[model samples]
Target chain A: MYASRTTQFIVGLFALLGIAALAILSFRLGKISILPTPGYVIYANFDNISGLKPGDEVDIAGVRIGKVLGASLSDNQARVAMEIDKGVQIDNDAIASILSMGIIGGKYVSIQLGGGDKTLSNGDIIRQTQSAFVLENAIGQFINNIGQSGGSKDSSSSQDSQQSQQKK
Target chain B: MQVVEFIERVGAYILDSILALGNFALFLIRSLMYAVLPPYKLRLTLRQIRIIGAESLMLIVLISTFTGMVLGLQGYHTLHLFGAEDSLGTLVGLALVRELGPVLAALMIAARAGSAMAAELGSMQASEQIDALTVMAINPVQYLVSPRMIAGVVSFPILTVIFNVIGIWAGYAVGCGLLGASGGAYFNNLAANMSRHDVALTLYKALVFGVVVMSVCCYKGYHAKRMATGVSRATTEAVVLSSVLVLAWDYFMGSILL
Candidate 1:
């Protein structure tokens, strides 16, 4: 006995869906791994890692240009090593900075490739690098400034009177 | 004295069923290894793949997407209480991968495939097709049961993987877009929580479910030639048995694996 034409339709429908599912899954994983690109890596020395890890995206002027590959420390400095795409060029005066999107956001290496005449080579060292700024401390600084501003006049007068009485 | 005799008879019936199950299991495992052996029947396998694997994808995807969205929404609310929003990605991933994906795929395939299979086999049996095959010296077991068995064995886990991956992505879309989670963070969370082993377990479950549904439908249809109305009964019983057994084994496998 033959399965109805409806059954075939249903089967075909599901097959389409399965293929779609595979496509969607692969897409979400952020790389379908078409062909591996061989790129050169450069090293930047830092005092701290600030949680920058491998596979973290690296951007130049907010455009993705490379990826962080490794972070290790030598005797005097922490080394941040990265793989830059062969297609992209980095200036010799370029700098890598560790940035946070928000208070709880993960760390990423941000490259500000300068407009220098010469480009940095594979093992070139970036002279300037910034570590991740702690959000809690920034927030604390803001609140402290607000508190000081609100009570500044009263505190100044009290200090003036106390100083005059001590002079008397 | 009568009650004692009744108890003895019921015990014997249960024992016989158990024996039948054992023999079926042994035969099933052996048949399974053969199904995987090379010099493969690419044409038949392809047809079954279309019937079994491809045809079942949509319902599985739809079911999984919704399940994931619901789980994501509910799971987010629950997890947020513990200040564990970070874990929501992993949580939804694990639920889809280990729990919902394989089980739902098996159930859907059973409904779509198992019933149709029984009906086709039953109709053939009712029309004296088995007698014709016998006269031609063809083994009905190999021709009728083996392909479906192989199809079920192969299809279930493939569907499971589809469901799991799709369901989690759907969850990610809703959770990230509608729920205002960062797409990068949500996927990173899922990638972190997901493991190769989870996929492996899902595949294993699918294989078991495949065997269960196939054997069940086959068994019912094999004996369907007993009466004039027996084919109809067998078809109905095949659907019901396959559905129940799929669910039962789902629960059983869940307990062991999860």
Candidate 2:
């Protein structure tokens, strides 16, 4: 069956509009990286990773660079596998910190780029990591310090001095 | 004697189902093979794209708008309970982009364009047009099936993207415009929480749904019995089966992609 010329014109015009919408979505909403480079995976070990899940953003200097590929437990520590974008080179000594978007926002991993000349490659692990802060633990520690100081001021002072000496 | 008859009937039914499934798989393979081969039939494909994608655009947009409004209204109440009303935009955006947009778009296409394809092909088969093409040394499957399948595959994702954009706008209109929710917070949270991965997943789901719609509807139409009633029945069955298949495929794709 042959369609009228006007009908065909309408169809062609609408089809082009639909395709244009697809292009707009892929560019603006999808943010599809046009680059064909393959992402490299790396791992970090943390003592605590509360509230963080797979697909959480991994950033460096507040700029997103990757995502959490997966999270697992190994030898009583939380191990997170990250898929970093290609061309983003992380130094071997870089630090990974569990951070939150805000006080009530979701958690993510923030990387502090290191000054070392050694760059981390695929499958390399970042050794220096900071765990998520748990409010209950801090409260408990605060209560313990208060009780200890109240019970024996002199003993608490001596303990603080000893701890400072150890740090030195 | 009765028990033996019942067993025989059951066996026949099972065998028929298996045969039908085998034919469907073969049809899908043939369509894919022919789609990539030479003699592309670009004009026919474009016409089918217009019929399938362009004709279904209004329906897709209308349904998406209502769905988005409902999501925003419901999400507003739910999030308000947790003092998270600012997240209404994020909730609606993610929900549409990641799930509802693609699924609804596919379902709409299957209902409108897919049924039309089935009916047209069915009538062609009933009236001997398919036979005439075959008699002329034309490969009916390549000319008829491949073009429609390729068009469906290419168009569904485009329709879905349009559906999602309209849906998100509708949600914003309802959430911030109708309700007293803060407009800035709604849009800001949406921008922050929505991700590229979600959009990509929507497109992937739409593509699979498109393939499912075309293959299923085309199979039903191609194999329809040579009668007017048969053509009608095939049209109904094509619409119903393609709708169900799109949903099932959506579930499977969601599981895999997630």
Candidate 3:
């Protein structure tokens, strides 16, 4: 009963505003791209990926050049696929390393450009790859070394004291 | 004898609650069926949208802007201790997009439009207008309830998107402008962390909240007692019940969707 030309106009405007808002949320804020930018895929194998996940940034000399596509395990090694932007060229001897953003931040792939003549193309694997440095493992190793050396030194000193006591 | 009486009362209460639940379910089904059937009530739906969505837009905007600013201030202070104030955008954006935006917007609408719906329908029922429609061979549920339901479902997601966009910008203003955080880091972190899944979750929650809010409000009003204070009582009950249900369903959906 309240329907009128003015109401219709306002409703139309409201609908349009809502649509525009939705568009901004989806495309700009959410960063949902309808068309995937032109890119080529490359693969690297790591002994351990740690917690590197898909969508992690792939960087070259501190600059992002691609993103991790996915990670899989084959032949007891972690195989990671990265989607590199088309224009960036990767040398045959390039190295890919899994690095963290900060001390407690998320993991990402870093590429080191090599001075090789041959340029790797799509589907080529980077031969030199470094795995993620797990903090817990490093700490464990450090503690183990300390324990071993400390025990040996303490035992050796006690044995010399025992020999001196016997001589006395 | 007392024990027997207590048992009888408990059984009666259980039976009554079950019956009420069944009635509500059937009411929702009928409203949905009418909503999708032929002879669409586009005009009435538009009018209801104007009442529920457009009229409430300003309120939603005001609440959302403040909410975003508060989030930014709080996030910046907390993250500043850890030297990560730059992540303010990510924190604010994710929190609003994932949880606050849909839930708060729906609650606001429930407070504004849902109470009005209940009062209107309750008064109409008290005056026997619904019965008159039925007597005239017109379906009152189709004529009144279905259009409101359609409008609720359509308007809620739209309003939620608007709320999110405004809230994020407001947060950006506080974070970058007032707090002196780097604008690039704020937006870069936000863009990197946000994904389509988060956006989908926002819209999905809005849709479900819309269904819940409309159903509870309409159900309460449609069956409100035909008495002097019935309209006021129904309106109060509609607002309370819809708000609670919106929150409860939001938690349930969030657990599942996330």
Candidate 4:
């Protein structure tokens, strides 16, 4: 029986406040963009993405400008669709590289902006891409080179002398 | 003969479940259609929102804060073993936003507001007030059920967003303050890793859970038998059914959405 007009008004006010709180959460905490403009999508192909997955950030000069939408295989190469925010322009020659946070960290895509007269449009493919660094491959190559050089004692001694001279 | 009896029972049970599903679908569609139709009870809807949403705010905030704090603490210790303690922020943020925030918020609402809504309706049914409304040329579904359902669907997602924000803050406090983790790293990683899509998906889950909670609870209460014990049983069933559906639907939605 709490049907008084005042009670209704008060309840309405409370509900409005709850809605305001949700808006704040969306804007401040969730970082949801309220812009109605749909962002542009571009594709980048890489030979090996390492551990890069969808939802990973796409950063340009350490600033995130886009996110990986999805990944697919095209002609034995990994194809990633990236959704970049509107008003941000990408040059046709921009390089997409899969980067790690740390030595053994999560993977993300880094975009090195290019200075080209022509600008990339929606659905444009970025041809120049660098794969993520493979730790095992680098270590294996290092060990292989060491094995190849280990048989030459004279050359190894000469290199050691040069390293000691540099230290001195 | 016993085996035949068991088969008959199983068949009957399957039929009953299918009938229940069809009835629920019809009820949901009718209620939603009423929501869009005329004679909108703005005041009643607001009152329901107050009862369903505002009343449950404190419990949501309290539970979310503690959930966030515990997640942060556990994540910090676990990630520390791999020397990736800084990633705790992203871990906590993603977990709360993606799964825990919507599921736990819905479960809480189902317990607090959903159960209460059912009990209220069940009592009203037992007292024949719903029948009285029908006698007065008013559709009980439109007047009683529609407002509650609309309020529930509107309130739940907002509550979920509040839960997520509070949980993130709680995680920040415990992980950065107590564990000596860098507050900067905690927030920075959270901001960097969590995207709008994740938040949007979370809101979608909350919306679906809200509809499920209201429909199941309201349906049970609306059709409750006209007896003292029947009303009580209806209330219990409403809570149990809605809670179980919330969890099951969460899994299905996560598999598809995520």
Highest-scoring model, DockQ: 3
Task: Sort the candidates on TM-score, descending order.
Answer: 3, 4, 2, 1
TM-score, candidate 1, is 0.62
What does chain B score (TM) in every candidate?
0.86, 0.97, 0.98, 0.97
Answer with 2 or 3, whichever has the higher DockQ: 3
Model 2 lDDT at residue B66: 97
Residue pairs in clash, model 3: none
lDDT of 1 by residue, B164-214 (tens): 887787877777768765566566655534544565677787788888888
lDDT (C-alpha, whole model) for all candidates: 0.71, 0.82, 0.86, 0.83
- Kindly list the interface RMSD, in angstroms, of each predicted candidate in the order they appear: 5.2, 3.9, 1.8, 3.0
Q: State the weakest 10-residue window (summed lDDT) of model 4 chain B.
A: B184-193
Candidate 3, superposed: residue stretches over 4 Å from native: A142-168
**Model 1 bad stretches (over 4 Å):** A1-168, B26-42, B251-258
Backbone clashes in each candidate structure, one number apiece?
3, 0, 0, 0
The ten-residue window of minimal lDDT in model 1 chain A covers: A159-168
> Candidate 4 lDDT, tens digit per residue, A1-168?
655776676567756765776676566655556785378999988877878877677888877787788899998988899999888899977888888876756788989887867889899988788777777866665576577765567545533432211110
Clashing residue pairs for model 1: A11-B55, A14-B58, A15-B54
**Which residue pairs collide in model 2, if any?**
none
Ranking by DockQ: 3, 4, 2, 1
The alpha-carbon deviation from the true structure for residue B240 of candidate 2, after best TM-score superposition, in angstroms, is 1.0
Off by over 4 Å in 2: A1-12, A23-27, A30-49, A52-168
